[model samples]
Target: MVMRTLAASLLSIGVIVTSMQVSAANEPIQPIKPVKPENAELVELGKMLFFDPRLSKSGFISCNSCHNLSMGGTDNIKTSIGHKWQQGPINAPTVLNASMNLAQFWDGRAKDLKEQAGGPIANPGEMASTHDMAVKVIKSIPQYQAQFDKAFGSKEVDIDRVTTAIAAFEETLVTPDSRFDKWLEGDKDALTKEELEGYKLFKSSGCTKCHNGPVVGGNSFEKMGVYKPYKTDNPAVGRMEVTGKEDDRFVFKVPTLRNVELTYPYFHDGGAASLEEAVEIMGKLQVNREFNKEEIANIVAFLKTLTGKQPDFKLPILPPSNNSTPKPQPFE
Candidate 1:
């Protein structure tokens, strides 16, 4: 009778262990959803505007110059080259899954993508175009006038409407259905054993504390180095510039880790050139733990699994500017 009782207990324990393992296999991060724009016409107009170089004062730079959709929604440069080859202060973050961020930009200064759109246009180092000039340039185009009318139900092409439409299109740039996402959806075999081990280590080592959620790390602001100071020549004081708070000096928005494999040259300073280096640096700075070479490789393997499906859309054909349209002043 004791032997039978022992066997039954062992069976019960096995069942319990299996149930827990199955539950843990499920993901905490949510999958990206297909975008359904309220105004498809507006999205179309925004797409044209997004690709049009005429929006810049120089007429040489467009939104796509830095945020190239063909290249992981980033220029893949350490820092962006702006108007007249002016170097930007920080690295250009990927625009993919940007709408998933709690706020836009590394500093989190802009509340949304719409507000973020207007900054570079006016920044002297960036597009170097005043809001009024951008509006005037767009207005000068007859085709743009018709598009504006169709999009907003009025021919009034203003910065607000322009940014609104741009933001609408940007909202559709979600990347979904990565291998990690597939594993998250309960496809047990979606990830390799090494990748699964890396994920377990990633969580066990406390990466998930900051990198959890749909976009996997854009939800909040954190200091660049929690355990040690991050050394960089970049003069940007991070969130301190935005909030003017002393404690917020090193604080910056946590970039999303989705497609991190593609958005290389990591961090605001773009210091870490490879995934392994970035992982090691992050582990050392954030958690005060130094990841070994094998550990770094495992983490990188897991990170590569985060690459999702890129947005698929035809290149937009921008409306032509008429003779009355103000010509771009690239040198001036």
Candidate 2:
């Protein structure tokens, strides 16, 4: 993804994505850059919390349930079915590169990933449980209590530290290289001619305005109907739900285009089912240009090139132990 468009986000009117002058109807109205942390302990703690499903009301839905490392870090469901089979309105966003986001959630409601991680547990439509109750349940298990002691040096569990550990883990969930990244580093063979042409069109067509940066799009939020209204039978008001402003209505976070192919059911609302259809919709909604069949296909190919091998991050097993003996498996 391009960097400039992501700097300040696209929520503001007339936000430029870059300094370069282009003929696209909309151009760089913002700037962006890739960023990372220099810490260690928090990330370690976050990793533990990420895999511990005990935080959920059902004790079955870890962050991994929605953001698996093997599948672009996003659950494929159009909307995740949570506790008691409750359905959410939007598709799950990939946690693969969520650490880079300026605001969490499709509506930019949470200011950071740390803040976002703690939200669902008590959300009536999501995890639907209180921290006090959740901690009581997990601590009841001897294995969990021991693990918490080792990971956080405590005899008790709490929600704040739980989210801290998960956020730390999320910070490590980044994909740094792909065919596109290789091309950016000056490897001529990294991208195919068709992919290169698609890349050219991607930038020239004004997608870069809201879809650039290291995370590709997570860095900003924008009106979904800038060029055309996104057609829908069940419409969501998006950011306006949080901001309570008329203009913010239907404005959702611009997801990072990274790993676009593996993470399907696109957009904040998951309106267009396939990437091909999603691209076509973007053509009308954001770019105001109609994509020909070949153009759409080429764009899909280029987007596919954005995807790389699945990220390999094995979740650490729970219950840190002091014994030197080898751990036992379920078979034993």
Candidate 3:
């Protein structure tokens, strides 16, 4: 038997596969739809751009370095280590259904993927390059310059085209074919009885208030400690840092529960280590009740059901050998 790697542990956080519940009371939860292959050629081009390390200051790290599709779209670190091995203050969120979010990033700083894509590449702690530097680096290679023109009709590659290509690729990263989706589609026998019971406990426990709907999350932002503030001497200034509003302090986007099984070290801060412990912490910090071991176990089981399927794409063979001058190495 193959031993479970970080991927398995991330994917098996709970016990069963599950789906979003739609009711008459409010808007239906809709998982992000897969991007139409309307332009298969562009998607393919975007795919290469997405994987090409040439976009980064460090030749070694592509978008995949932090957001591995096989690894729940996150590298499972509390905070991302960027260029020069510098640590980002915020947790690395999964990129799985990020296109659905109204704002991207833990602090809700970015307005769209096109906007979000450029953040890390130039963050002082991340890829660390100016727009001019990045454009110049990518354009140094004739192949990349040609691909840029092909992808965006721009012989002169700029920050806009680069981020657009990456964002276009991200729009295609939706994962919606989990067993839970199958169950939602009328496959009554898809989930086991225990898993079904766990789903009940998940809702009754009030997890669904903030965690319901498709994409499972990605709809709204809520303060972490709704009932009571999470105790911290130096809590990460979540939404407040962005909005500069005291009321918005500690607010965070409710993350999609899709593939929650594989994206553990849960919560905005990644303080919860195990599913049970995470549940325990949520109850105390947010829900105001201690979780019984079995209930916690069941909730974990239901969360597993949210692990949807994703399609694999081929990685780009690099050295960007076809290109002329190599892009500047961001992390090197």
Best by TM-score: 1
Ten contiguous residues minimizing lDDT sum, candidate 3: 15-24
TM-score of each: 0.93, 0.81, 0.86
Give the per-residue lDDT digits (tens) of candidate 2, residues 27-97.
Answer: 23222223354555556556766776666666667777777676888888788877767788788989877
Over 4 Å off in model 3, which ranges? 1-32, 232-235, 319-332
Best by lDDT: 1
User: RMSD of each candidate?
Assistant: 3.5, 9.8, 10.3
Deviation in angstroms for 321 in model 3?
A: 5.8
> Per-residue CA lDDT of candidate 1, range 7-106, in tens?
7787777864444343423555676666789898999999999998888999988888889988888888899998889999999999999999999999
Full ranking by lDDT:
1, 3, 2
State the displacement of the C-alpha of residue 212, model 2, in Å, after optimal TM-score superposition: 1.0
Ranking by TM-score: 1, 3, 2
Report model 3's TM-score to 2 decimal places.
Answer: 0.86
Off by over 4 Å in 1: 1-26
C-alpha lDDT values of all predictions? 0.89, 0.72, 0.74
Residue runs of model 2 more than 4 Å from their true location after superposition: 1-44, 140-156, 320-332
> What lDDT does candidate 2 reach at residue 299?
84
Give the per-residue lDDT of model 3 (tens digit) for 124-210. Answer: 677666677767777776776677677666677788878888788888888876776666665667777877677777777777778
